[model samples]
Target: MPQNIYVDSYTLESLSNDQNVCNACRHLYIKWKNENSELSSILDHFKNDMYELMNVQVQTEDSPRLTTEENPTLITTTNHQVVKLQLNAASSFHTKCCVCVENLRDHAAKITSQNRDFIFFSRNIWIPEGARCCSGHLINQLLLKEAVDQIKPFSIRYQELSSSDVQLLLNKAQNFVENGKKIFSFDDPRDLNDDEYRLLTRVSRDNFNDFVQTSSTIRPSCSRSIRTAVGIYLCKLRLGFGYVTHQYVIGRHTTAIARELMCGGDSTDTTIIIIDRTHLHIQKSRNNKFERKTFNLCKKRSLLKSMMIITTIGYVVACIGSFMFNFNNNDAGITKDILLRNTSNILSWLKEHDILAVDRGFRDSICVMEALGLEATIPSFLDGRRQFSAEEANESRCITKIRWVVEVANRCLKQFKYFANTIQNSSLVYLESDVNCLRSHQSLSTTYDKI
Candidate 1:
């Protein structure tokens, strides 16, 4: 938006409210208040609300207290003989104010008489990423700006926290420990933004359980609930982070860490079950080099090597097993070979006469399917002859309509940037989500893969 905004009390009110002020528009309020605080009353309200956010107790109960409005910075505004924090400062004052004795939540609890166990840590306790109790204090940007002004300019040194202090941070953040339940307040699941809804639809609690059972590989387990951890992972993926190592650096929602743990370590263990392939002209990556990589002669787009596989889902079963690799040549007749490899169990999973919607690429696989006493619905082939008759054309159209969901399903995988972008290795495979449960129809999401 334009830099010169209409700054009125109403604008301030909207920008500062939790329900109305989204992350994107917050900077607008901050910038405006910094320039014209006289015109913005709601800015004060916002700052007040941030201060009220719960944090730890003070060690020195009798010491004088410093209010956020009067003293926002950790350091004193006056030259207070260089307020320097040492290596053990965080550990020593784990329950004291970041700036003074009165800032701790524990101290606040004593005053208010609340019994919730409060834990506080700070980014400034030591080096960046060091965990120290700012004496149960945190600073919103406004208070931080004020605090920095109070401290001597360029007169500070950083001290790293000890291992014990760091462990305190781990105890608070690590998945094995219990956490506050991440609240889900969706009145209607559709109310969720596209990615959030798609995420839930794709990997419901049922799907996660199925993953635990069916995978050939053993997945690492976490201490948190499945829903919360999955939510964190989805939130992270939606944010476009590409590495597992970033977990240590990124600050995820507290509610999310548990399930995010379920989506742990690496994408290598993931296996995408392409229930049906060849229904659409799939997009291939110009970058990655993995098994199913192929090129589209018609569209001339770089095909990120991709795949399609069979699964038993009259309506989305848990992903049991996966067949990741596909024909190097798109026209190759390997679908039948893959099925032959798993004839016994998979065939039993399929009900009698279950229809397999496929594209012409699987033409060669049809005989094997029929031979195995199953039904297949594929588009009519021109077969180097004349165009299909009217009846044949209608049948092809119907088949395409039914099978397009597979294309949408693959697109769903690409919603994650790790799958959409070319990676250093093909070892990172796509994850198969609950397919039929979601409406994989083309128009389901407008910007589903834009990120």
Candidate 2:
């Protein structure tokens, strides 16, 4: 055997099957004792001391470690070798071996009746977590893992382990459950009031005029011109009053006050455009054959699409650029035709590289604008087969940070009962009410930064 190899030949070649190693050690010890009585006497004394040390450390009954001191050099290299063997044996699978080559069932009488249990009280014990030793030797539970599930034989009470030592054993078996010493809460305990939160969600109307004038598109016109038609339409939608009642209120004919307000006018001087879209439900004319697509994501039912452009600052709606009826279909769908024709601006504004803050739905519109030399800023796309790369995800987050205001603007339009519902009108009638919602919201302002 090499210097590092400690186990005797009988133990190693046993195939770990019904193994019995201690008999050979005793036989070797007896051989030495017969050869030299003085050395045997000293070794016998040392053996007793080793058993006492193991008894203090381990919880098991049979300290096969009892005979580690059988070596003649118990005072020098022998003691160290025994201790090293004990530690190594404790950590390895042999620590739990309770199998006997013969019958140790009868040997159970060797220990006192109070400590009568044999090391292998139950043979063939399965160990999923730690060693599956047959258990005739001193075992080390400290060396066992805390994670794997393991089986233990009932030789436990034999070692004379105290309550504290038992606790250590049980703790190793427990695999470490959380003690739950810390507390968790959903809301902040020190939070004062929701007033600030409410104010932050809405924009104020004090600076409403500036926002509108700066943001409004070139007045789209019609038979009544864009402004005249829009004003009359708003009066009707705002109150939900009949066209007759609204006509009396605004001095207009009920016949002329139709739902669709056409924009036959021209685009004018305008900058800083914030464009948004809304669904307008219309009574299906011509046998009601208009196949309206459903959009559950935005929670709106519509046969028509209304794209409105506003200034960055206020409620001024510059243009109701397109009233697209074809949705989710081929042939450019809603944004098929470019918006520049409906919008009034310096053609040079496109060359000036004006940037428009838009929503994800208008993502297609960005390419249209880019073709005409304009820039658009929109949120990033997070949904796809693979995850977004770091740079793409960061850019998407940045875009959403700036795009929330457009969402707020859409919510403001939805507040109106008329604009909020599906419209029965086939024309651009509701355009005025939707555009004027900015000015009407003046009553809703507290500070200029109410948004």
> For every model shown, what is its TM-score relative to the native structure?
0.37, 0.34
The per-model lDDT (C-alpha) reads 0.36, 0.37
lDDT of 1 by residue, 127-223 (tens): 2222222322222111222222222212244433332332233333322112223234222121234454455544543354344345435334565
Estimate, for each residue in 69-91, the C-alpha lDDT of model 2 and write its tens digit.
Answer: 55334333322323211100112
Per-prediction tally of clashes: 22, 42
In TM-score terms, candidate 1 sits at 0.37
Residue 392 error, candidate 2, Å: 2.6
